[model samples]
Target: MDSHNTLSARAVPMDTSNVQIPIITVWVVMTALAAVTVCLRFYTRHSVIHILGVEDWLILIAMVFSAGACVGSIRQTFFGLGRHIWTLSPEIMVQNGIEQFYNFLFHTMSLSFTKLSIIFLYLRIMSHGVQRIATYVLLSIVMACNVWVLIYQFIQCIPLKALWDPSVPGTCFPLAANIAAAVLHIVTDFIIFLFPIPTLLTLRIPKKQKIGLVLVFSLSFFVCLISIIRMVVLKNLDLTDVTYSLAASSYWSAVEINLAVICACLTTLKPLLARLFPKLLGTSMASGESSRPNPLPRKLQLEAPSSRGRPSRRECWRLVQVCVLPPRVR
Candidate 1:
């Protein structure tokens, strides 16, 4: 049954079709969308908020890697990515493999940095408490996993050139290693998706604003779903007709990475969106308080109670503002 399944996958109608156009279309469109969102995010951070956090810089790095991945995918199409392996010349096959190697590196870097950017955003919002500690733990795990993957990416095959040049006399790890990495990625996606919910729920914001914030962060759930779908495609991949069978996996992989970038940028775009659609995001441009969308300063977050044994009304209000308002709104 296993052999039959693999054989059937290779024989599917899509495998015989030239998917180069569709693949290129998906990558190009997604890259453009991600690029625009990233630009707007920077505009909001610099012009509207007048503050740029570490998360912003990290996301910019992620976008750079995402662009690299997009370039790799487009290049692969020209090297026979959407055709059967048997039909490709050995030279073309080697070229495609080289592109694939770089694509894997770029995609992995994009995902790691994108995740780190979101986690840092969480850190900025969360007060020093158990929740903050949890965020740190998640950050550490993500960093460790990504570092492991990066190391494996370069050394999985002995004599590095063996990865693309099959004629090289060196061994490579079995396909199971790649599968394990994919599964780990999906697991982290789930964790990151759920990490902020408890903090959001405990916020003292208005129900409407709370819901809007939740919806904004939850947008990454769609990226999680795309990751799972891409993992499924990879799990059943048939190596005999690798070039053809891998097309769907590559398409979905590009979608997953680019869509993640789009979602990450969207979270920081609340200021821009609020300026345009004041009624929707609960910001009124007419009001000075809502017009200046800057984050509370570090000193404000560390302020202490007055000599009266409790925080003053002014300090309490500032705390409330910190918690109830979005970073871009504070």
Candidate 2:
């Protein structure tokens, strides 16, 4: 009966199975993503820094912070993971545990720095009235929440070795703490996304342009969704199957890293893309204006009109054209 059970229970062995290589692949992709993320940061640094004026200092500070974090994370992934996540020796597990802590710390910091910079840039872009105030408020909350999450992770276990070697004399919290943190992370991610949507819709740009901007943010939100799913996977991990738990976490960790890079890349690229591809966006915007004929001088409306007191000659002309122009001709 015991032999029968062992045979019946046979499945993939997480430790010996070739899972680490694919996990390492995720790391390589994440590193490349970080490289591009930094390049994008620099791309905006010149124009965004100047355009931002007095608020420019904030951009610089965010840039330095993100750069440090991204660069540090990339280095750690390149040199750190092989020794930390892949080794089989018990003696190495403790040091690997320390590396894992730093790895998570810097990655989270990098993500936070990059996100704050993106938020500041958007605030500058939409600088006026209520939205600006809201931007700062939302940012403060996101930053605070992220910092708290990091604190919880670091302090989740005392006498640190318990983190890697739970069989040692130290005691630690059950898995519930980690699960809760992952849930909070998913919540924070959605908040970052929803913060900009309504204000962006209020802009004077074309509806299609508004949609494009919204879609950019929506991509960020999508990242948040992926994060939430990753969190759920994290919550399912059980130490009862140490091999399988480690394997499952290894994959989810990569997903989280790549998603971080994606969010970082998109946010930093916003202003530059808008500037570079303005004409494409302008065309998309104009198409949404009105398929119905307008009653004005088309050429003049395309050029100039009234500021305030003056009747919009363009509107008057459009009215006349609508009234006078033959239906067939129109």
Candidate 3:
């Protein structure tokens, strides 16, 4: 009998198996990195440049939402996330569900704000043209999508408490709703990732500055990739063991939002880098400004020599300094 019982126990899965450590570690590290980036961004804008635009403030708000999502993710682990659903008590399951709900809410708000920050940054540098009009249209779409998503997320279940407390008599949207949201999210990510390329190409800036801008904007594509990965992970998730199955999705979500935060801040950090590392960004950034709203005047004379008496050497030098040099680094 003893041997038979031991064999039966061995055949059963271990109740202690959980992915808590990995999930918590991912959130903690991503949140820390995001915090550092945001602090650096604020220092660059407020202390170094002494100009804080709406974009800066929007990014700060996004950081707060991202931090909240991180906290919610960690809290879920304590409430039976990353464990077998069968092993958790109903109360713990309900608590975990509640955390999951809020975590999703936080994630949505964070991305929305980060994208808004990026849109505003684009507007600041763009001139009055098709690029600006397209940006305005994108801005309207983002705002409308955010409002709809926020409302839908809150009301997905009638009698909100029923979302976590399944015993309550209420209805909730099907998984199809989640799939729709994820699809829209991915589409917007792609749009945002590609929006600035055409404008960047049209700008009559130096080749070097154009390259640098391309590289900085390219960083956001990573966030888009993370969002795609999370969608894939969630697509195959097993609701029967949701707590354990959702771990990978949660990890990618944390990474996606924090990375968005980092990218948004990084675009504004050129001045700080130029200050610290002088030649790192080249002469275009010598003045520590990154965007150029005004182009150099075309009528400025650069062909006439001092000997020709069109303009003295000193006078030409002054004109070049004021006209040719980038007021903002482009």
Q: Considering every candidate listed, which one attains the maximal TM-score?
A: 3
Model 1 lDDT tens row, 97-178: 9999999999999999999998888877777478779989999999998898889999989988999889889999988888
Show where candidate 2 strays beyond 4 Å.
1-15, 47-87, 126-128, 241-244, 267-330
| Number of colliding residue pairs in each model | 0, 5, 0
What are the per-model C-alpha RMSD values against the true structure? 7.2, 9.8, 7.9
Q: How does each model score on TM-score?
A: 0.83, 0.67, 0.84
- Candidate 1, superposed: residue stretches over 4 Å from native: 1-17, 283-330
What is the C-alpha local distance difference test score of candidate 2? 0.54
TM-score of 1: 0.83
What lDDT score belongs to each candidate, Candidate 1 first?
A: 0.79, 0.54, 0.80
- Give a tens-digit lDDT track for model 3, residues 181-262: 8878888888998998887766555677667778889999999899989888888889889989999999999899999999
Candidate 1 whole-model C-alpha lDDT, 0 to 1: 0.79
lDDT of 3 at 71: 91
Sort the predicted structures by lDDT, highest score first.
3, 1, 2
lDDT of 1 at 266: 76
